[model samples]
Target: MNSMKALSVIFIFFLSLVTFSSGDLIEDVCGTSSDFKVCIDALRADPKRCSTDKKGLVRILLQQCSTKANSIYNEVASLLEQAKEHVLIQCLQICKENYDNAIDDATSAIKYFDANDFLAARTSTVAIASAPDTCEETFNEPPVRISPIKSKDDDFMNFIGLTMRDLIEDVCRTSSDFKVCIDALRADPKSSSADKKGLVHILLQQCLAKAKSIYNEIVSLLEQAKEHVLIQCLQVCKENYDSSIDDAETAIKDFDANDFPGAMSAVSDVVSAPDTCEETFNESVKISPIKSKDDDFMNFINLTASLINQFGN
Candidate 1:
């Protein structure tokens, strides 16, 4: 009986030693991060996450990022209600969107990490790291400065970003596609790091580029159909293209000047111009004795309209 009791005490002591060693390992790992104190505290706060491995440490960091991002998102949303100044309200709105994206990316990182897709996990982590900068960039324009809320939120997000970045660096040290994935994401115009206004600008630019392409296509089609009975229909479509191009250009200018409402109105005009052109073509065909259809031009107009509508939304 005494032997059995002594053996049990020895086993317990061994277990205690293992636990302590695990904790020390976690601290040592976290110490390499930018914010070691915060990292250590977060790891210690969740003892269950101390798996004494790099992957486990990354998971813990991602989980903390998700929690912190969600909290910041909620706080920014709540602040929107009390915002009275137009500039401040706009900044908050942008911040809210950025935090929303950060939360989503963090959640995605956790999912990817669970699946052992370290490349995707690191990509998401990099996006989350940029969210705070994207949010803060809105107030960098002249005559509008960062507010107290912005300062606090920036600090909070920086802390989370630094923590996640350290984990991402660890993952990238072994990930073959880490650099490629990161470069692709950064080059993408729809990067999560882009501010709302920047995204809108990109959308507008796309609209303009598409509109110009369609305009050239319409001109070519009109010339080809000049001797055909569909000449009238082509002419009407050409006129619509002219108007659409003009409206899109105006919208781009308005957007550049920060006149959001005006830009939206111009985009609406661009969207409707194509519809009216298509309608006129259909009506002309219906009245004409020649039962002919140009599916190609119709499809082109339809696609352009669809793209414009999507960007407007």
Candidate 2:
């Protein structure tokens, strides 16, 4: 035990020597001092000194500086673990300074990106606002000294957009005419439709799409933060849904008040029309039993007989 204790002391001494000699690798890139207040302030004041391209340079600095900063932090932490009372305080101070400096570098990158409003240009306008904190919460780790917000935003939006497109196609397999009519009015960037009847069906489908959008946003928020945010978001969606249903009811009421027969005639036509289901199921054995010509003829005669019997009664 005594020999082991002596060996541990020698090892720590050697480690301290190494840490002290590795004076300032991070400082060389950032500056001569551990305090980055002056360095960060100067960069903001006249950012050209940092690099030629303001946005690109800020990103690069954050990326490169983070690795060096982490090394410094680890060294300081290790030194603190083996320090005497006198050196422990100094080590703690240095650790705090380095950590803050790294965070500031990250903050600078975020500010530069925000100033350019890059999020709007890309599809990540929403994710950029929420991801930094969300990523930290999910990892149960402190926010990284460097965050690739722009890159992450791009990946997230691309994946969601593709998924939404696939969902839309799978759910709505109407005729080309119907699809065209709905696409024309759906504010979708794809195709257009000319059939009036198809537009109504498409509108209802769009309501579902809107509900899904809000649900996704709520889920993403809940994943990142408290359940309260998700609940509030859902409440907003419910209110919006109610308002839309009320508007639709009012529109229908007005139409009926002005022309009840006209409204009924349109509804009757839709009821009698050969629906998409009939077109798609035409050859299936299940439907042929009812739609065959022999069955139709028998049904016609039976209907006439029933009418004659009714008059006699």
- Report clashes for each candidate as comma-separated counts: 0, 3
How far residue 76's Cα lies from its native spot in candidate 2, in Å, is: 1.3
Give one digit per residue, the lDDT tens place, for model 1 in 1-313: 1111111111111112223344466665554444456556666677776454555655665666677778777888888988888888888888889889988988887898778676676667657755677667777765576654565555554443333333333333332344533333334424333333443455556666656776676677766664554677667766766887888889888877867667767877776545666677577663422112223333333333333344345
Taken over the whole model, the C-alpha lDDT of each candidate is 0.57, 0.34
Residue pairs with colliding backbones in model 2 are 180-192, 180-193, 181-193
Candidate whose TM-score is highest: 1
TM-score, one value per model: 0.43, 0.18
Stretches of candidate 2 off by over 4 Å are: 1-58, 114-313
lDDT (Cα, 0-100) at 57 in candidate 1: 56
CA RMSD, predictions in order: 17.2, 27.4
Global local distance difference test of model 1:
0.57
- Report the Cα lDDT for residue 124, model 1: 71
